[model samples]
Every structure is written in C-alpha cells, then in structure tokens.
Target: MIYFVYQILPHNCRSVRSILCSSLFLQKKGKKGAKAVEEEPVQVDAKDRIDFDSAKQKLQAVVDRFAKYANDAKLGKTSPKVFDNLMVQTDHGDQPYTSLAQTSIKGRNFIMTVYDPANIQRIINSVLGSGLNLNPVVDPSNKLTLKMPLPPITTELKNESVKELKNVYEKLRNGASLGKNHTLSSIRADARHKLTKNKKLDNLETEVWNEYEKLHKIYVSKLSEMIKAAETAIMK
Candidate 1:
C-alpha cells in the first residue's frame, strides 16, 4: 500500500486535485493481478477541479471579521460582547480581554471578574485605553471585580460612530477587493502552469474565472448588505 499526504493551503487547490488523481491511479495499479499501464492519462474530475468554493470560503472569513467590527461599531447600546477580542497590551504580550477575565452585563453596565487578582490594573488600563469611553471602576473591597459604566448615547456620539463605521467599511472593502484580485491571479497562474503541459486543460482558466466571478458577486453583495444594515442600526 502506498499513501500520499498533502497539506492543503490557500493557493494549492489545483495541486491537491492533481495529487488526488495520481493517488487514485496508484490505488488502481496496486490491485491484485492488475497491470500498470505506461503513461496512463489520469482524468481530472470536474467536481474535484472547481476551487472557487474554497476561495469564497476564504473571502467570507474576511467579511465575517468585518461584520464583527461593524457589530461593535454602534453607539446606541452597550453590551459585554463589545469587549470581545479586544487586544490588550500586556507585559507578556497582547492578549484578548476574554482571555484575561470573564465579562457579563450588570443592568446597563459591563462587569468583569478577573481570573487573577493581580491583573486588576491591567484590565482596567485596557478598558480605559479601548477608546470605547468605558470608565471602569474597581469594587473597593473586592479587588478582583470591576464595573464599567456604559456611556449615554447622544446624537453627536452616534454621528461619530457612523463616521468611524463608514471609514472602517471602506478600508476593509478596498482590502478585500485587492485580496480577491490577488487570489484570482494566483488561480490563473496555477491554471497556466497545468495547461502548458496539457492543452486539453485550456478551458480550466475560463472555468476558474467564471466560478470566481459568481462567488465574488455573492460576497461583494453580502458586504454591501452588511454595511447598510450596520448604518441603519447605528443611526436608528
């Protein structure tokens, strides 16, 4: 028995397909009483050849990150979730707020119960530095507990949040577009590499572009819808 392993990366989709076909060929040759044919042409299955799904999956990841930011980019209300994944500069390194402490909602305020009593000041400094205008107060006797008062929402603050939201949206949108183009270029290069050895694979490049365009439109539309929804939520 022979085995081949591939480490699937973002750009190696085509290479994996080729390897799978080769593996199938090997398996067929290994059967008892089977004869190995010289220079057998391995058929690349159409179902296996399409990589746009993977590309779209990667694109969705970018959009998802943006969506999280968008969700937190509002001035209307305060939730403990707003502090999720907030990177705090620590003596060791940068760490997420959730890693340092557990947060919960106490009426309109966000409460944090630190895991380490000594980390109280670190958590406090992080919340103060978050730019979310959360002024955290320590529970005098209970040093491990901290409470943050959610700022009162105002028209001016809402406008500022919306402005920041638009800025972040534009930046992420532009970056995603560039990333999409780069991925398309990489897929094109892979197609060309394979086509040079086999002209029968000429249609491979066309299929790649077609599939990419379809998925591209889907994700682009999704991002647009997200921004519009976010803006509406913030302004309302």
Candidate 2:
C-alpha cells in the first residue's frame, strides 16, 4: 500500500497546498519476508510560509537603531593615533610648540598649532588653498588653532593593509589548529617567512610603504605652505 502526504501552509495569510511526497511506500519486505509499515515526515518550504512584510519591517527597525547608535556615538570617527603629529621647533631659549590646541571639530579631533597668532588667518587660508578641510577656532585660554583632517588616502591604505594582515594571521591560526605541535609564535614566524615569498603580501607591504612616503611628503608640503603663509601674513 502507498500513501501521499500534502501539507497546507499559510502564505501571507493565504492557504497554499505544499506537496511533500507524491507517493510514500508503506509496505516493505522484512527480514523473514513479512510486511513492514514505514512512515516519513512531511517537508514544507519555510520561506513560502514566512510573512515577508513583517520580516522586512523588523529588519528595517534594527537597521534604524544601528544607524542611530553610529551617529550618536561618533563611531565613524577615526582614532587619534592614526593622525601624524605636526611638530614645530623654535629658536634657542624658546620652548618648542608641540601643539597649539587639542580640540574636536565636527566629531573629529586634531592637534592644532600656529607659529604666530597674527598670521592665523593666513595659515587657515593656506590650508584651505591646499585643498584640505579645516576649522579654525580661537579660545581665550589657548592660542589660535586650526583643526585638520587626516589624510584620507593614507589612512584608507593603512586600514586596508591592517585588515589584510589580520586575515592572514587568522589563516595562520586556523592552520595551526590542525596540529597540536604548532604554537602561535612558531606559526607567526612561519607566516613571516612565507610572507617574504608571497607575492600578494609583498605587494601589499610595498603599497603601504609607498603610501607612508606619500603621506610624509604631503605633511611636509602642507607644513611648509602654512609656515610660508604665516611668515607672509606677519610681514603684512
């Protein structure tokens, strides 16, 4: 004897008949040729039964909450250590100005400095002329300061390199898990040795080094421009 099973599932509150099996054999030959009865569970498509509208609404709510948190907590701001510090040396018997002010503008923080207060506007103009974003502020308790944004290309390249290195390390760790004899240090050493021969890793390292050089050049050029502008403004 054979039996057919059909399951009716609700799709958006509408009844839809879902056939699990066209025919299910109920009788089978036993060890001694006796008849045996067998039963099988019916399968249903879960996706067909799901309420898409409700799911989409719930998912949207979660996305909205995450967006709110990201904005409210300033999660998109880069860490301060990522920025290269600009140091200015002074003549003998004068204290070197390390930073004019450490302040936040538009959710990003900067260590700002100006050589002379009289040329502050010139410095600001020079920075703007160099196509860099800046927010100049004067505090009664502190010197005139200019907020500078980090170099986007350099930061992005560094972040990409870090992410790639992390992925490589994860692969190394996963490889180590296959053998109890392998330690983290040993794996790291092996990975370093392998990286020397790895074309991809070598290319990434070279790119990162090149980006650092570019960043240095940019920083020096901007600093020089600012200094020149300040001196010019002072003369006027």
Best by TM-score: 1
| Candidate 2 Cα outliers beyond 4 Å, as residue runs | 1-77, 92-142, 149-236
lDDT of 2 at 119: 52
Which pairs clash (backbone N, Cα, C closer than 3 Å) in model 1?
A: none
Give TM-scores for every candidate, taking all chains together and pairing residue i with residue i. 0.55, 0.22
Clashing pairs in 2: none
lDDT (C-alpha, whole model) for all candidates: 0.69, 0.41
Cα lDDT of model 2 by residue, 15-122, tens digit: 645544222332233333453445678553323333334433433443343333323222222433222233333333323233432334444445455656765565
Look at candidate 2 and tell me the lDDT of residue 154: 50
Question: What global local distance difference test value does model 1 have?
Answer: 0.69
